[model samples]
Target: MKSVLLALCIVSVSFPALAINRYNVQAMSCASVQQAVKRDGAAILRWQSARNPSLPLYDRYVRNGLYCDPNEYAKRAYVPSQNRANCLVYKCADISDNLLFDD
Candidate 1:
């Protein structure tokens, strides 16, 4: 019993208490912001989308790169004039907007 308890304690402490996958890509240029979104957005969406539908994952979008709005990524519109739209509209959208792949 003591060994089991010790093992459990060790396992718990070995990892972060709150292991959050954060992509703090903020106040960046158009290209940099696009890159960050393209890179991390898909992973974020996958992890978020896999979870229970009741527990939704709230993500933001950088419209004009001045602020980070608490907007659900899926609910955003396609703006042609959008500077960073290439990333959201093309790369991430390629996976999200289309029936590209399941995995």
Candidate 2:
């Protein structure tokens, strides 16, 4: 039982604290929203849709391409914040989208 407990403790300590943060962009200033993503490396920014106020929109924004998957690349995106209609940020997009298809 002691050995199992020791193993569990070691496993817990081996990993860094990588909690994905979520925020309501509408409640935060554009700079605040950007800072959150930069600080966390990645964060889910949520806001209500403009066309449909009842609809919610959210996506994981990243600080840079390093946070994206191998097959994905960072693309410019925007989210609504307290001070701006479109606050610039980056989000992962499928790399295939950039490839040219020859007929």
Candidate 3:
């Protein structure tokens, strides 16, 4: 009974972490992406700006309904404008097949 309780406790502790899945968006520029992320709380895995390869992942201050214009800058670190309609939005669903939770 003690072992079973311990196992249950461990499972409960790790459940939240396991439920959360990181998401990545390919943006036209880091600034735009950052702005959008700041307003959306969406995790930015990488930013492929036109002027740079990629930016390091960082936590952003997201709000709600923040708009981003990818082509606003000539020199950008990412370029999601190339395929705005079909741009890839990376989420846990893309990486895993398990329907355990929604991030």
lDDT of all the models against the reference? 0.38, 0.90, 0.41
lDDT of 2: 0.90
lDDT of 2 by residue, 1-103 (tens): 9999999999887753346789999999999999999999999899999999999999899999899989988888989999999999999988887556511
Give lDDT tens digits, candidate 3, residues 8-86.
9999999854543243445344454445544444444443445555644432222222222232211112225323523
Once fitted onto the true fold, the runs of candidate 1 whose alpha carbons sit more than 4 angstroms away are 1-26, 42-73, 77-103
Cα displacement (Å) at residue 38, model 3: 10
Better model by TM-score: candidate 1 vs candidate 2: 2
Of 1 and 2, the candidate ahead on lDDT is 2
Query: Residues 1-103, candidate 1, lDDT per residue (tens digit)?
Result: 9999999999998764344234423233446545554554432221122246354443443333223223322333222222442234222223244343532
TM-score for each candidate, following the candidate numbering:
0.24, 0.77, 0.33
Clash count of each predicted structure: 0, 0, 12
Indicate the worst ten consecutive residues by lDDT in candidate 2.
94-103
Q: What pairs collide in candidate 2?
A: none
Q: Once superposed on the true structure, which residue ranges of model 2 sit more than 4 Å away at CA?
A: 1-18, 99-103
Winner of 2 and 3 under lDDT: 2
When summed lDDT is taken over every stretch of 10 residues in candidate 1, the lowest stretch is: 41-50
Among residues 3 or more apart in sequence or in different chains, the pairs in candidate 1 whose N, CA or C atoms overlap within 3 Å are: none
* lDDT winner: 2
